[model samples]
Target: MSAASEKSTGLRIVTVPVPLSGRPCEASASSLGEILALFKIGCLLKVTGNQVLAPLDGTITDIDSSQLSVKLKADNGLQLWIKVSEVSLQGHGAGCFTRVKVKDRVKAAEVLFQFNPAMLKLAGALPFARVIITNGQKIERFETTKARQCLAFEDTLFTLYV
Candidate 1:
């Protein structure tokens, strides 16, 4: 463990929310450039697993079933937007199963949704998840784990300083 892993004042820890075995990379602009441009500070995780977990303890403020996305407000007031699949898959939520609903309080590592990665691939959509800090102004800085690949609930994704 590093110094950042230790509990400290004004620091909040976020973990890998998806139970997928893949690498985390800086989010890039896709075909939906305008929409993705808003996610300047975001991470993209390659899909491998079926379940998406809560990155931190938070309440689901909004859920778009057809879009396969969830907006959560952390206990510390930080907001997050987690979206599965790319723009092409939007409104085609056939294989995606959302487990949590709006207003539901979830713990870190709680299952948020599940999807069939194979099905997404067969549909010509690259399976991935976009995790973005919606209210980034509240964060002073954040350090991402050095590891290239991370496991959900077990690996710390980012240590946020408020």
Candidate 2:
């Protein structure tokens, strides 16, 4: 068998906590139902955090202007064609919320909107990432196929299947 193949002969897929990124559970004029209807500029987003910490704590990448195949990081290619309507994260990273629109003024730590990373293909966190010991390689995954509760820095949140 090929090296990569042989190495993965007994490997298993496991899900782990990725961290819920944003929470816009507040009163707002715009409904999530409205934002999701958009398929263009207000679509697809990137976050830089895990389900164990606050979101928006890292750099953000936007895919609103570029089509999927051309506008994403190579490492993030797994997320391609996932039909992301928005990218949300909690305090610290470039966040997601209803406060976003063209030409709108925003600042760090400001509430953008309400988002529970548990709803999208991945609201970020997942409790199913496994650790396999096939050929001595560490593997972890956040599956779009299953959504479960993942712990976050002293807290726990139920991530929904998106």
Candidate 3:
């Protein structure tokens, strides 16, 4: 469905945070068990691009010391968590450059972090950006896009019914 329909249906749509040229897969408990088990449902987007963007308008709530993860709280009260790389590669010369800090307000499509995909791959990291809805329990209906491929800020990543 289109964002235009969101007003009528009382739904909120969140688009892909980063440009994805590789693939997009469902984030499951098994896949993220090592990272964050709190992510019971989310999306794992292959990191073909070096930069990660804001999925929606939100305030930077928290950022990990290793610069591998960031948490945002959208204006609509939806909480999102984004991880740059695999847990195994954290602080092992993964070379992630984070742009925002806690309490910073961000607009959709704004650059949040930059990293080297090649460097991550060479270090045996999967190079996937994990986007998790931290406050997913508050959502009544959560529908994720089936598209295996997506473009930044253009394709819908998921929709939430509150």
**Global lDDT of each candidate:** 0.69, 0.26, 0.69
Model 3 per-residue lDDT tens digits across residues 1-162: 666777788876543344333367545533543444555457777666777678889899998736477888988777888776664455436776778889999998888777778877786667677777877786667766777677766777776666
**Model 3 misses residue 102 by how many Å?**
1.2
Q: How many backbone clashes does candidate 3 have?
A: 0
Clashing residue pairs in candidate 3, if any? none
Ordering by TM-score: 1, 3, 2
154 Cα displacement, candidate 3 (Å): 1.7
Tell me the number of clashing residue pairs for each predicted model. Answer: 0, 29, 0
Which one wins by lDDT: 2 or 3? 3
Residue 84's lDDT in candidate 1 = 73
- How would you encode candidate 2's per-residue C-alpha lDDT over 9-99 as one tens digit per residue? 6544322223333232211222322432332112112322322222112222332311111121112112111122333333223232333
State candidate 2's TM-score: 0.22
Which runs in model 1 stand beyond 4 Å of their true positions? Answer: 1-21, 29-40, 88-93
Clashing pairs in 1: none
